[model samples]
Target: MATSRDQTLSIVYSSTATRPLNDADLSALLAISRRNNARAEVTGMLLYRGGRFLQV
Candidate 1:
């Protein structure tokens, strides 16, 4: 897809957490993230692997 100069392109960024999160922490994070994302019209997925998080 092509975008006009006046329009900004949407990009996907991912990051890994510095440490592992417990169940409670993860739940709280998801809850807050969902709320914020919904309000901002943001959509993405999160992956937990080997004590780290990959969010995009």
Candidate 2:
């Protein structure tokens, strides 16, 4: 049997950045995202290329 807490939700989305992100900016953004997601017990992957972002 599976309880509500044992179920997990998954989401996938993509977006274009309004402004380009440099290496430093991208690194900082990823660091913050990792920290926050860890605190919320969430796991996923993020991809950035050509000023676009894809998160799953």
Candidate 3:
């Protein structure tokens, strides 16, 4: 069994993309999660409202 490097990523997106995220985007996000977890990183959530990004 392969160990999971990427724990998880929870996102609440706003102003949906012209094209919703596909497989590639999902893979990339997973990669980020792994890298973050490895370094004891704090993964932040970005909120887009009125074209502004709010980090929470």
Q: After superposition, how far is residue 18 of candidate 1 from its true place, in Å?
A: 3.3
Candidate 3 or 2, higher lDDT: 2
> Across residues 1-56, which tens digit of lDDT does each residue of candidate 3 receive?
54555566565544554455666865786688668866976666654444344454
TM-score of 3: 0.37
Candidate with top lDDT is 2
User: TM per model?
Assistant: 0.64, 0.89, 0.37
**Cα lDDT listed for each candidate:** 0.76, 0.95, 0.59
lDDT of 2 by residue, 1-56 (tens): 99977999999999999999999999999999999999999999999999999999
- Number of the top candidate by TM-score? 2
Among residues 3 or more apart in sequence or in different chains, the pairs in candidate 3 whose N, CA or C atoms overlap within 3 Å are none
In candidate 2, stretches whose alpha carbon ends up further than 4 angstroms from where it belongs are none
Model 1: weakest 10-residue lDDT segment is 5-14
Candidate scoring better on TM-score of 1 and 3: 1
